[model samples]
Target: MADDETRVDAAEEKPAAPSDSDLFRQSEIAADYVEGLLDILDYDGDIDELVSAGRPVVEVVGGRLQALVGQRGATLEALQELTRLAVFRQTGTPSRLLLDVGGYRANRRKELAAVAKNAVEKVKEHGEAVRLEPMSAFERKCVHDVVNAISGVESESEGVEPSRRIVVRPAD
Candidate 1:
């Protein structure tokens, strides 16, 4: 009887996954926040709010939007965090919101894929670990995905934020 009660209590303590509707609501809130920001900045763009891959995604497509992307997508990352905060304020729950401006993330993903491949090649050739420059969490994930797909090499992140980087090593 005690074991049954404990099992029930543990199940109640586990948080339920957000439904698709909830994810869509987060995207809508994020889109509204981004639209207001674009208006303030006097930037022209079309914002799309949707749920993709179990997460909320807000994409802004427009011309001359490099300013929003900033150096190495720094500005875009900041905007994404702010938008997530806005969604949290309204929904009282944290959101995994992906905000893309001018297709920066897609382009960067391609670039990171190439970089990861090159690092893997070096590791395989020399049989030594290759240390890559520091990158954001998104960038690191991109590299990890690429490296993980390939054989004879493995990847791991080292150090801390803004200084953390991927180290590709020969598979043992």
Candidate 2:
């Protein structure tokens, strides 16, 4: 009887799955944190939060959000890290939240995809390796994805940060 009771107690102690409420709470907390940041910088932007692509995504859209995005999206990446840290502080769990400003990430992603495809074609046509200009980690990821999707070419990142480029070679 004690063994059976122990099994029943263990089942009762199992935690429930995280519901949509849990996800939305994360977004709300993130929005508040970002709002404070904008306030401190005297920046103006509209914050929109929602579940996108199965993850929490927040976008700051406005003219003044440019500084937040920074050159080559460096500031934007930093802001993303700070936001994740804020979320972690509140929830005690790391977040995979995506933050976009002034539609920069969306536009950049499109451009990166094009660059990757072009490199892919070059590798296929010439049967030689193609080296692309250095790109950020996000950009490298986009290129890696495109190359992975293509059949004849493989891509890898070489070099160091701020100069890390993608090398595309024909798959052996």
Candidate 3:
């Protein structure tokens, strides 16, 4: 009986998953932060925030917003971190906030997916490992997902941030 009571207590203590409303709130906070940033930079853009894939995403669409994306998306990554900090300050919780400018990430995802598939094909044909160019965490994750879905090939990241890359090879 004591064990059963303890088990019940543990089950009751488990935290509930965040509701969609909570996710939307986080997105709203992040959007506000991004909007302020765009205003400060004197960049004109339309900002939209919403919850997707269980996380908050803020997208900025405008002509000539490439400056915000920076080279290799470095600036965009930094902005995402800053936006998440803003959300954390408001909600007292760390946020997985995705910030994009001028549809860069959407286009990049499609490109990376193609790159990953090509790498997979190469590994399958050559029976050897193939190293890909350095990519952002999000980019690497896209490749990882694509490679993971395929059989007889595996992908892993090798290096530190800003230089980290994915290596795809035979599963064995």
**Candidate 3 regions off by >4 Å?**
1-15
Model 3 weakest lDDT span, ten residues long: 14-23
lDDT of 1 by residue, 1-172 (tens): 9999999999889688899999999999999999999999999999999999899999999998999999999999999999999999999999999999999999999999999999998998899999999999989999999999998899999999989999999888
Candidate with more favorable, higher TM-score: 1 or 3: 1
Which segments of candidate 1 are over 4 A away from where they belong?
1-8, 11-13
* Superior candidate under TM-score, 1 versus 2: 1
For candidate 3, write residues 1-172 as lDDT tens digits.
9999999999989576678899899999999888888889898999898999988889999998998999989899989998999999999988888888999999999999999999999998999999999998999999999999999999999999879999999998
Error of 2 at 39 (Å): 1.1
Ranking by lDDT: 1, 3, 2
Which ranking of candidates, highest TM-score first?
Answer: 1, 3, 2
Off by over 4 Å in 2: 1-21, 159-163
In order of appearance, the predictions have TM-scores of 0.93, 0.82, 0.89
What lDDT does each candidate get? 0.95, 0.87, 0.92
How much is the lDDT of residue 141 in candidate 1? 94
